[model samples]
Target: MKTIEKNVGKKNIVLLVLPQVQLLDIAGPCDVFTSATRFLANDQAGYNVFIVSGTSDKILYSSSGMSLPCSHTIYDIDFPIDTLLVGGTEPGVLHEINSDLYTYLRHIVKETRRIGSVCIGAFALAKAGLLKGKQVTTHWKYADLLQKSYPELEVNINPFFIKDQKIYTSGGVSSGIDLALALVEEDFGTFLASEIARHLVLHLKRPGLQSQYGNALPDYDMMSSFTKEIRDLLKDKLGQAISVEYMADSMHMSVRNFSRVFVRESGMTPGKFLEKMRLDQAKNLLEYTDMGIEMIAGKCGLGSVVSLRRLFLKHLSVSPAQYRKTFKRAD
Candidate 1:
């Protein structure tokens, strides 16, 4: 492998984009690096971002029907990449993994400081054998497929972004911005990153562990009739003190059988599903209503503020107050 010499002053951040790319996956991160330059003392301490086409073409069409002009092809990149991020394409493009692209990625991995993927871009990295045995994530919709495709990799769908060693993978579209902000924080400091985030009009520079607010509901069509019935019952009586035994009796089954069937149908234990429901309700109330923590807790059937805070901390790594402050919708 031929080594590319690192740039002396500004770190060169390269984004590798393929055809039918998601525009935000490229634009969001590029904006973060570009915006960071404004706050820096000089150009020497900033980032220089470049867009490289994964294919031979210099022009790539985005998933949104926007045409993107690439400055360089993958073969044209001879300079050292401080960070290399792969932007995702539409699902149809993901099926055809380019062998040449994979080879280029493998070669470049030796010269890059850190590598990352935005959304389904993890598929590219995985195809190149870059994510072997690494804990990573992608857009929630494709997390299951990615897991099945690469059994060696730990595909966690919950986090907005995750960094394992030098590789970073982010969830859906806007999560690329979060990943870039974190990268900026790592390269410079929290103060600079926070300033950039503020300039971007971001309410909060959410941590990597923060959950992605994707589709939270289980697949109703796939659930058994009994499971669907229990789901509806739980939804209607979320604020009531409902027990597993009660649910079991209502369904005319023993607790053990009910638990087993629920797990098989819902893909989570009955207790876990109930907790998730309560948490989802609590989150909605926190985001949309001007309610007190205790009131919100009671409304969500969490019973007390302590339980609510504990649940938030355990799942979101943020307190109820903090979550409210960050996500509260403008009235």
Candidate 2:
């Protein structure tokens, strides 16, 4: 083990891609680092990106159906590393964590500058003993399983990602992009990193812990059949006139009882839940489309641009126009 006191000049970075890696997980960081390189004065040769695997020639497939070519096997790379990114594969895709590979990772950890994982990649690091006794995070779906496997892991379930010293871990699919942007900010400064975020059309940043409480990925079956029915109706008629009384009648219950059951079951008032859902959709629309705010508001059940701006101010801390402008830049 040696101390990384000498700042290694823009050096080689090995990205270890795996079988059934999630598309966004690998693409997110690649976009960030590649974009960051172009903006740096160091001629963008700072990073030597290599797709490494256990068997060098194996076709690395992602869950999104993209097949990436492997340039070298783990055993083939002899050069020292600056960053070693361990990518995630589907849960059952690669059951065998090669002992030799594990040993190799442990050896390299001492020399590595920073280690990173997107989503479930934390699992590989944990298995390698690199994450033991360290604060880390993974996609919430696997948070319990990872903790149960290694109680020594101080798993933070609330953040989209967590970093303890040189090792960093990110939450599920989309959070990988956020994690990559943060990495860019660290390496090339916020100015260029924000530029990459703009080119990628990603929100400049999102508080890592914000999405955990939104209840988006929670099982919808947690709601009863009737409750689901009403919710589905709301999704369908987002622009339709909706009220507590109307919602109650739609579910064939009295307004008072419906409100009580909705709150009891979902942990939020029905109106609040619908508002969150609408705002979430509106946020996506604002980022991904060229539609006017008024149009997005109409589609998201918020009625008008005014209502959408008010929601953005309270929840996202930016106006709809501003978010779009900041994220849609070319440079």
Candidate 3:
């Protein structure tokens, strides 16, 4: 693990933005770096963060229709860049970008210490052939398209962010903040990163392995009528101790037949679906209320705090308390 101690002075963080880029992808990481400077001692070095436009335009319009003024183009930067991040744009606009931007990216890779993308900016990096055979991620909705377009890359949509050697890619818009905080933690230490997160009023500094979707339910439209009925029943009685036999009886079928039909319709056994439903309920309670762990556990039919912790750890890689801290609504 290398640190900013290797660098002699302030590290230069250059974010590249194009027309119709997502604003948060540019603003989030920049704010993280700028905020870090406020906590640094006068003698200590910090980050010099700036934006460079990929196009020749002096001003770029974001996807949200906000205008962003840029003083430098990619060609204008001659100094070494410690980190270079690409902000995301719509998929349609990605196709419209000029080839010169890809050439510039290929050329700039030689001068940068590290490079990364926020959201669908992975497409730009992929277009430049910078991510061949790399395990990466983008927004979950576009994960399949990214993989289909670039067969050589492994696209995993689970995590909020991921780092593969010197290259990084984040899940969606706000995950840029998570990625930037990670970079800060890497350059300095956890103490500085924690301080920055607190100042930003961030509830949780999520790990890279944490799933982007949490325990959210899959699309109901994709489920069969039988599966939907079962889901409805489970939702109403999530706090009760439900057995496979009870489910079978409610559906008016033999236990064996119920198991086979449920698997056929839901793609999972009744027990597995029940557990997933319980986990979803538990997550909802954790995020929306101030209930204690034991009460939440009982209400979700998870039995005890130990069982609840185990369920969260197995599925989410985070403890119940940690998940609550990260996602709980503000009072």
Candidate 4:
């Protein structure tokens, strides 16, 4: 692998394309990286990006109709590279990467300054022995498979991203932005990162180590129809005071029995669930809307800014004002 370095612009960024690459996984980060470099370049738009794949260096069409032209083939490029980024799929396009792809990966891992993968791309890196004994992450859907296939690699899907020595890996699709932001922050500073995020309209620069389970709740599909009804009712009545007993009556059950079953299915008591819902809403409002803290409190069912603050601080570990100040989308 050969690398190219300019005086101040982005070093070479190589994205390996494979069959069945998820459109968003590849495109989303490409957008962010290009956006970040443009902002950093100010007037130059300095990144020299290339999309390469296992096959010919033609237009690598994604699962979606969008096609990104490959600047060159992996075999042809032998420049000093800053980074090699791989995109992932639900199940990757290749069952096993050809010896050529694997060899190219090994060559770069030994030569490149930093190596990383997005989503199931981590699967390929592990397959090529690029992530051996490295702390890594991938989309949650593939966590089980990754662990089973590459026990030598330390896999952590909970984080937005993970870095082990020279190898970096991130969770599902959009998370690549988070990892890229972290990289920009490392290479430049908080100001550059914040500006890039502003142009990209990313609200928060959530740490790569931040738990993906920060507020994980059961999926809508996991809920029974009755639970869905209850969940819907809660959302609708979020601005009002609601009680478990009231919910029980509406659902045609005794309060004690209803509470018992709700907790069992939701993994949280009624009060806790309600609090989470309100706080989640409050968080969104704080991040994206200009509603006053007091107004947001009322709209999200916390009733008062004081209660909202307490809950946000308790669970999210940030004050509403501080959170808004930091995470408010810029552009």
Quick one: best lDDT, which candidate? 3
lDDT of 3 by residue, 32-82 (tens): 989877677534577888789998777999999999998688868767899
lDDT of each: 0.83, 0.73, 0.84, 0.74
lDDT of 2 by residue, 292-311 (tens): 88889999878888998998
Worst-scoring 10-residue span by lDDT in model 2: 1-10
lDDT ranking from best candidate downward: 3, 1, 4, 2
lDDT per residue, candidate 4, 1-331, as tens digits? 3222223655677877876777777677677668767665544434566777766556666777677677777778866788788888545465644667777788788888888988888877887888778888887656645776677877766678888877889887788888877776666666766777887788546643333233333446655676678889888788998999999998899999999988666655888878877876777787778989999999988878899889876765668898788777765
Most TM-score-accurate candidate:
1
Which runs in model 3 stand beyond 4 Å of their true positions? 1-7, 207-331
Q: State model 3's lDDT.
A: 0.84
Candidate closer to the true structure by lDDT (higher is better), 2 or 3: 3
TM-scores of all predicted structures: 0.69, 0.61, 0.66, 0.60
Q: What is the lDDT of residue 51 in candidate 4?
A: 76
Residue-wise lDDT of candidate 1 within 22-118, one digit each (tens)? 8999999999999887677574678889999998888988989999898999878778888999999865586674678999989888888899999
Question: Which candidate model has the greater TM-score, 1 or 2?
Answer: 1
